[model samples]
Target: MGKTAPPSIVVVGSGLAGFGVLRELRRLSPDAKLTMVTLENGHFYSKPALSTALAKGNTSETLVTSSAEKMIAQLKLDARIGREAESIDRAGKALCTTGGPIPYDRLILAMGAAAYRPAIEGDAAHRAISVNQLDHYAYFREQLPDQARVLIMGSGLVGTEFANDLITNHYQVVVVDILTLPLAQLVPPAVGESVRDALASEGVEWHLDRKVVAINYVGDRAGYVATLDDGSNIEADLVLSAVGLRPNVALAQEAGIDIGIGIKVNQYGQTSDPDVYAIGDCAEYQHGISAYVTPIMAAARGIAQSALGTPTEIRFPPLAVQVKTTLLPVNLLPPARNCVGEWHSVESDVDGDKHLFIDDRGFVRGYVLTRQKTEQRVEMDTKVGELA
Candidate 1:
């Protein structure tokens, strides 16, 4: 009898989830023929640096510690960097690319989300950018001059972080959003207000209840004049479209895979088709949400074990999404649904305080903290763990 050939696995995208699956798969099945494909050069690093760049005065190159070549050598896996997957032929079990088709027994899509930009008329709108990837951050950093005016279109987590960073970098920062409060949709109202105040004290401007209707170039200069719906206008050196993100689910949808807000997957990160799995921002898993990194990290081991044939049952816990911002001296952990609660604020010296949320049942489902009040994080974590 001939020796059975090892399984062949192909992973698309080189972000956290894709690389994570690749590493986990390698550990689970050493002999599996693995290949990774990415549209961008698969330089690996912690992506949270996108927001932290301004404070560090670091460019993308400074944040990216390893190149695709180095990752390939280190991980000992076949790599196809800077190549886009044109389509997937599931019947043929092959991925069609601009280069050629590559066959695989199993495929994983880790392609993340594209920044969402609302339809609005504007001149020099081409100057608007979303710093989602390292490349994008590098490009924007190079384009910025000292004391440049930056107008961000969202007051969400990403927008707030950028606002904090730009302030630290001495850039005049303005945040515009339809929501009356920054981070309203994420953190509770009180916590959101405190964060807004902190950023304001740092010289960040907030234009709540306003929207940009049009953007036009300011003469020949690399600038844009934004016309607000309120008949007010602001000229800015750059516009960052950080409103939100839409998952990359076109490939999965076209391949006849079930997709909702993202690629629908089971508890183990298995898609409708057992052989074709999804992870990261592209995957809507058992819990029905796929945005942050914590849940994705929790799903990695289960996905890997299943792909390698030594299947393991993994139950995912409700992971807390931590927002990294300098202005807000706190962390927020909200429940899954739009569950409401009353907040209790206790002052902790001058720099810190804890905001605890108690629901109708007197259960603490969420929490917000300042630097000094962060000591209760462990207590909140315990409650969250019990709830999970």
Candidate 2:
């Protein structure tokens, strides 16, 4: 009898999640038949680092840790770069892409989310750029004028980070958000205010409890006029949208896969189709979406191992999400949405603050560390009431 060929694996997307699984697979199985399909050129860069890098005078080119060719050679995997995975044909065990169909014994979908482009009224609303990838950030950097005035939408993690970087780089910045506090979803109100004041000291104009309702071009030089929901106008040379992300689930949904906030995945990273798995921003896991670094890595490990013949359970500790605003760094482990909790300050100083969320049951549900206090991460994680 002829020697049977090794099982073929196809990974859709080249974001952190895709890379995580790729690395795990390579580590576990040498000479594995692996193919990666991606929408963009698969150069590897820290997507999270982009917001903080501008202040250090780093460009997109410098931010990329490795080129696509370098990564491919390093991992010994074939890549179909600049191609979009259009659909999945489970019965045929193939992935249909813009280029063509590729057969796969196992498929991994890590099609990360697109930055949410909120609808605004006016001609230049379409020009509000959002950076969700290296390419997007590159374009944004190239489009800005020297020391340009920037209008940033959303005071969340991305927005706050960019504001700090831009302000530090001496760019005039104005930030608008519907939320009352900066990092409202993550840090406590007082901590948010502290970071807000810190960034404001570096020249970030805040328009909280408001939204940019409209935007229009002022002149031929890419200047903009943003109209708030309250009918106030702010002028800037560039407008950046950092609202959030909506997972790219259309391809999976059309293929009859279960969908939630992201593609539904089990503890083993298996989707509704056991042969297919998902992770990163596109996966709606049992604990919620696996969008951040730690969960993505854990889920990818489980997926890679299980698909390679080991059925391992995916587990990760309670997240300590970092808000990369340099003026005042924040580490947050916020309480669950349904938890009846109150944030109480455990420690405070002029430059830093720490707060713990104690639930109605008198259990430590979550914690926040800001500025100088963020250094105590290891010491603080022990205070969690339960291991989530």
Candidate 3:
């Protein structure tokens, strides 16, 4: 009898989830032919660090914890870095890439999300940068000048964090958002107000409930003039578009795989094609698109097992999403999908505030903690219950 060939497994994307899956899969099935196709250099770095790197005075070199060469050798992977996965030939069981087609018995799509930049009219609008990756962060850092005036285009987690970081570094920071308050999507109005006040005290100029309609370069000042919808002009050296992220699903959609806000996946992270799986920010699970770190890390083992012939069911515990702004630390565990509830203040003190989401039946569905109160996340997690 001839020796049977080892199973071939290919992973797309080199972000946390992709790299994590490879680590687990290699441990579970040592002889499985593992290959990775990524658009990045495949280096390992902290995604959260991008927001505060400037405040901490950390460069790209310090941010990168591991090199591509080290990760490839450590995992024994055939890493095709800098190669884009153009499409997936589902029927052929191969991934078509810039480097060429690679056959696989199982494929994992962890392409992640792209930084979304909305259209703002002006010739210099293209000067705005969206820091979604390491190279983008590097370029942003390089362009920053001493006492630079920055116009931040959103007040979401990334935008606020960056604003805080820049302000801490003595840069003139201005944040413009259509939303009424900072972290409106993540916390209650009161919490958002508190954060707003904190950052404002640190000299962050907030232009809430407004949009930058246009931008034009001012060569004399070495800056750009951003005109708001209200006809107000703000001079800025740089503009950062941190509006949000749209999940990467074009390749999956082109392959005729299911896609919602992101690539749809089942309990085991299996896509429409049973042999193909997706995890991380690109994957839309039954709950929703989980872009946070904890849930992504928790899904890695189960996903790896299911991909390598096991039928392990994937389940997630109540997860907390923390906003990494040192100015006003926030920890939130959101309510279940479509759960009817309202945020009720638990305690408000000079140090911080604590609030909980109480459903109609009086069950604690979710909760929010800030500043000193954020230390009680474990206690809050235990209190997270759902509506009947």
Which candidate ranks first by TM-score, i.e. highest? 3
Give the higher-TM-score candidate: 1 or 2: 2
- On the 0 to 100 scale, the lDDT of residue 93 in model 2 is 97
Of 2 and 3, the candidate ahead on TM-score is 3
Q: Which ten residues in a row have the lowest lDDT in candidate 1?
A: 313-322
Q: Candidate 1 lDDT, tens digit per residue, 1-388? A: 9999999899999998998888888877878899898988889877777987878867788788888888898778888887888888989999887779989998989998888878889656667889899889888888788899999999998898889889978899989999999888867677778888988998999999899889898764747899889999988888898899898999999989999999998776888988888998889876566666776776777888888776666566646556677767567676656556677765545766666677778777777777666667777777777976
Q: Please identify which of the two predictions, 1 or 3, would achieve the higher lDDT against the true structure.
A: 3
Model 2 ranges off by over 4 Å: 1-4
The per-candidate count of clashes, in order, stands at 5, 0, 0
Instruction: Please list the residue runs of candidate 1 whose C-alpha ends up more than 4 Å from where it truly belongs after superposition.
Output: 220-222, 338-351
**Native RMSD of candidate 3 (Å):** 1.5
Q: TM-score for each prediction?
A: 0.94, 0.96, 0.97
Q: Rank the candidates by TM-score, best first.
A: 3, 2, 1
**Candidate 2 residue-wise lDDT, 218-337, digit = tens:** 995658999998999999999999999999999989999999889998888899999998889988888786578877888888889988878888876676688888788888887777
